[model samples]
Target: MATLNKSVPLSAYTQFSRAEWAKLSQSTTEILSALEREKLGGIDETISADEVNDIYLPLSQLLYMHMTHSVNLHENVSNFLQKKTKKVPFVIGVAGSVSVGKSTTARLIQALASRWPNSPKVDLITTDGFLYPNAVLEERGLMKRKGFPESYDIGRLIRFLYELKSGYAYIEAPMYSHLTYDILEDTVQKIIEPDVVIVEGINVLQVNKKDRRIPQVFVSDFFDYSIYVDAEEEDIRSWYIERFKLLRNTAFQQSESFFHRYRHLSDTQAYDIAKDIWTTINAINLEKNIRPTRHRADLILKKGAGHRVEAVHLKKM
Candidate 1:
């Protein structure tokens, strides 16, 4: 674990090094194959079976424990009140800066959690689906700020979460396409009753300032557990550039890809563009919104170079 700075005040978390954290999963069986790990990992992300056994297996076990505890707590409260309560989904929020590999983390957790005894159902959703369409963004002149907090339909997101917590049998979320870089107009992803819902996005931890004028409720309120993937700013910037170069050679080659124009660019040109985007947009957003919420998460996964989780910071009960 990274040593805490004496200058900083005491935190509510107890830190654990990677070796210490890995010991917690000694009894958990490895359920994913090498092929599955390759498919789940994002571009430039170096995830392996060892990482699964050391980092994610323990995490899945901890999450399952938390879910069971929550169920028991609800049952006790309902019994005392002499009332019945429906089962509510346990929502987990995964937040981090762009290119921080949060999507891979969320998917791995979902896969491992589902393999537990009884085969509990799990659903994963990205906030990209809740982003405004390209047409709407152009109309509102927010094209450059597409990933900013203002680009999302906060009301719709809140209502969907509220309904889920209200025990809705099924809910639909809009689908977004990375190739088109837009929300599909009539497409929706239906989520049936799930034991766990993992909401993954860069801004999931953001608390909108505009909410103060109305009833105060942020999206993080719906999360039973939250994770913030952490890394140094310089390391993240390099990873973003590396991922961008790889995408130019792969996904950007597709004619329909939003970034197809970059596919033909020389290596130097592409590198410059990637660096500019990182410094101007992603880095700014990280400093302003995402990093401020790291302390708010129930758990923090601190990654080092090569995108390996070196330590875990778990909030003290």
Candidate 2:
């Protein structure tokens, strides 16, 4: 695992080592059960309780501080205006490259944040749900460019975020299935007014180039706070390969899985295929679309070789 550099001379962000950040958990004692902890991670991730205690608990507490402050600020404005307003969700965006364990980070935040006193509801919806359906991608000849910004229904996504901030009573986000590796038709995740909404995906921090000229609201515009999970490109590639190999014996065996054809591949062949996919598709997407947006985040979680968060970089106001 990488160690934090003590001196970050003349940086725009304040840096914290893992230990330094862990000390920030002065409040919030709510903890997930062992079973709950077991259920908090993504495929091929084993997040130790110590890691949660040393990392996520502080993160959860920090989010609570931000969440309450946002509510207070909203209340103050409403009072000054002498008008009643609907409760708006505090949106948090988690962005990162594929296989960077961002899904786990998002889920951990959602689970821990929801467990705070009085149990505020924290809803999570990934940007994968907004990706153009496989049918649409195929029609547009974007199957090879699936994770790219152009492959998503960016208009619809922007509208959905708009509605959340607009305080819609209930909104339906489209559903996506990893097994089929496509958007599920006629299925949606109905989200009521959640106190916090964590939108996780590689695309969350992106600013579409087309929007620059038109001056349109972006996905991050709706985010009250945003986190970008960072790591070495080669580390993520290795993680991707390991996950791919693991899936060959797991999800790939499912008849309905989009990659079911790869179920019978030998370990060596699986590595080769995974390497090829990562090299040609995922890595390209990360470089061109995802990693470029990391600097835009309010907070960046720098991960080391073992998927450990070695340091934290918080943007200075």
Candidate 3:
């Protein structure tokens, strides 16, 4: 685990040691049960009750405070203008490299935030739902760059966010299936007046270069607060390989799985394929797209080799 340099002058963020950050969790209660944590855990990602208490508990407490303050600010502005206004959802963007546990973090935060008295209606949506269908990607010859920004339906995703922020009565998001490894054309997730919306993905914080010439808005612009999960590149690669192996033994064994063909491969063959995918696709995307936007986040959760959050960096206001 890397420690912050106390002797050096900090510019953008105030770094907190894991022990120091755990103290903030004192004000928040542990509402998640063992079963809930297990359900929220990502593939091959270890998230014990202790990790939740030390990392996510404090994070949830801080997010709730931010939500409360934002509501009060809105109310004050509305009263100053002598007008009544409807409340909009507070959007939190979570961005990180693939297999970095951003999904797990988003789910955990959603659960904790819902339990908070200030915001009871919480919804979690991944930008994976906004990815173009495999058929479309194949047509565009972008199957290799599936997780890249250019591979998404950015225009549609932007419109959805605009509608969500505009306080629309109902918004429908397309569904993506992991089993089929494609966007489901017939299914949609209906979001109805949520108090909080957590959008998690590899490219949530990315600023699209294609939108530069136009007045189109990036997804991060709609976020009230954003989090970027961080870890060493090598550590993330190892985790990705481990997850691939686990899936090979479990999900890949199912005939319906997209990667079912790999189930019959030997351990060495499976390892080579996972390594190739990580190097050619996931790692390249991380270096080129995801990591450059880390500084844009309001908070950063830096993880160590074992996928534990070893330190926290809060952007200085």
Candidate 4:
């Protein structure tokens, strides 16, 4: 098994030049057009095509090359053992603090990779689906720490990824409801043999298991590649509060939403409430669990105060 070498600092990693990024952007015009269409049709939130082009295009291209290299390596290993092995899926993990735009990164990469000629069968599964049910968390007095590492069913999540990595014919993962904020027990999304699978979450790179200094395997151990979205803690906190206010006015007002009661607060009051939640729950999770794993990411998209990706750090291979 291969291990992630941590001797080099993230700053030591090289980045794509502006001209190269532009070229990658131009190459993915089709993807950008589709993304624009979604935004215009009001099906998606308003994020620019330039954002998708400049970031996700280059991101998917790099992932494609990495997946190709991984396949070659797997084949070489099989040859050494004199056994025929199927082409396993390339797993990519996207990790970050709350409101760091990791979801957008994951969705953009999925769309970009799915359109690639070499790897059309791309799939995405969020670790959110594996989060313990709200009832269970409430029972354990962990409702406030919803995004914490212990809030997830790590064993089941690991088993699901293991089966997928082993090239199972059809792997079915549980579905989650954002409105209810709980796992949908009877619902499953079947992923047929995909060439690439993107897994996105808050603690995807967490390795330490609390009681033990090292876990048997890091959650990121299953990943062929991993990306971390990074920003200043203050910037992320502000963004989290802003998003919470938006949700409180819109999504939270929905009858089925778990946070429906928060919608009753006025905008200013809601902002204050959201900030308190951030300072108490999300910030603690970021400091203790999420941020520590930044060093383990294969790449990091460091963001500025405006929530735009400012620097791309590609790990030395």
Candidate 5:
């Protein structure tokens, strides 16, 4: 773990170095196949067997324990009330800054979680789907701040989660397509009685000013556990720029893609645009919105250079 900052109070968290946390992974089996490992990683992400064994396996193990405990607790409370026990999906929120590889982490969790001995049904959803359409963003003058809190339909998201935890067997969440850079009209991700649902987004841990008042409610309220992927701001900015360059040759080449115009840009132009986007928009969102919620996460995975997690922090019970 990064040395506990003695200057600030951290009594509510237990910090562990990467090696210390890895020791807790008791599962000897490798659950991810080679193709799956490649598919699960993002363009700029480094997802290796070592990372899965050391960081993610222990997390999945811990999540299973939490799920088991919650199930038992529900049964106990139901028994005391002389009522039937209703099951709810274990909700795990993965929150982080853009380019921090949160989506990859969410997919890894869903993958490992579903392969548990009991074969639990796991579903993963990204808040990008909940983002207001690009046209709506343009009309609202928020196109530049598309990933910020105001860009999301918080009420709808809350309602979906509300229904999910209420044990709705068939729930549909809106879907977005990055290729078009917009919400797919009438498209939805069907979440059918999942044992676990992983919600991934840049703002999953955010608690807006209005939410801090009495009768507080936010996305984190629906999470049984949450993970925050952390790295220095400069590192994240570099990753964002690198990913943009890579996408220029890949996703941006398609004529139907929203970013197709960028394919013809020279390296210098691409770099400049990517840097400007980071400095003017993404970085501001990170500092003002995302980073502020880091400590609010149940688990914090702090990364070092090369996108490797070097420390872990678990919130004290």
Candidate 6:
């Protein structure tokens, strides 16, 4: 097993210059299979290849290395204790402000990690499935803070992760719909012994201390690694507005979308609406809750105004 000096912090492990960082971030030639590539292509309007290369590829590689070493250590310990070998899944937590590209990061990491020679079966899951339905949020008076910690079914989320890490062969997680903004009743997203699992959400790592009844094993307790995608407040606000405008022009125009009312807006009106949502809702959430988890990440990807990652913060090894 590789030894990470216990006394040394991970941040000091390696310092890459601008060129060096970019070089290290390059993607390998082989990615997903043809069918998977076609499916992922549909999301390209939101996520880009350059972003995947600079952010997700390197992050996934780092996680792979970390997982490999962890497995080796676990095997050594098991042998020392004369215990039987057991399967252990590597869990990665991706957290950030809504519209800060956490979803893109999650998808890219899912694709990249699965391509890793060491970990060939990686699965991606989101905490959206754990969110209360819009009706439930409205009834609970939490409609305004839909992505808040209280808006989640924390018990179910914890149980799912626990089962996955415990080597369950076929674990089921709820399915969530962005168009309906609700959980799909009786539907499940199945997982079958994945080597790596990426769990993405706005508050994946939030620990509630006020509720003494809350168990010590929070949602993030299962993570073997964690990533926080970060950008400046101004940059993120701009990106959010742009994404909202894009959705208004496309997805929001669909009859099935809950926000179809946005389809009637003129370009100028749509821009204003997007700005309003960003400034009033998303911005408030970022400031009040999301950004606070920055220090809790195992790795941090800091993006520039151009939306490309400029620097990386890996917790000292």
> lDDT scores for all predictions?
0.89, 0.88, 0.89, 0.80, 0.89, 0.77
Indicate the residue-level lDDT of 232 in model 5.
84
TM-score of each model, paired residue for residue: 0.95, 0.94, 0.94, 0.89, 0.95, 0.87
What is the C-alpha lDDT profile of model 6 across 10-90, one tens digit per residue? 454344434456577556564555555455543322344555555556666777789888889988999899997776788
- In angstroms, how far off is 117's CA in candidate 2? 2.0
RMSD of each: 3.0, 3.7, 3.6, 3.7, 2.9, 5.4
**Steric clash pairs (candidate 4):** none
TM-score of 6: 0.87
- Model 3 lDDT tens row, 153-205: 98888999999999997999988988778998889999999999999999888
Model 5 lDDT per residue over 82-116, tens place: 99967899999999999988888889998989877
lDDT of candidate 5? 0.89
Candidate 2 segments exceeding 4 Å error: 1-10, 27-30
lDDT of 5 at 41: 94
RMSD of 6: 5.4
Where model 6 places Cα greater than 4 Å from the true spot, the runs are 1-18, 25-55, 212-215
Output the TM-score of candidate 2: 0.94
**Candidate 4, superposed: residue stretches over 4 Å from native:** 1-12, 15-30, 34-45, 213-215
Residue-level lDDT tens digits of model 4 in 159-198: 9998998889899888899888899989998999888899
Task: Give the lDDT of residue 294 in candidate 4.
Answer: 82
* Candidate 2 clash pair list: none
In candidate 1, what are the lDDT values of residues 17-129, reduced to their tens digit?
99999999856565798888888899799578789999999998899999999889999999999999887999999999888889999999999989877588999999999
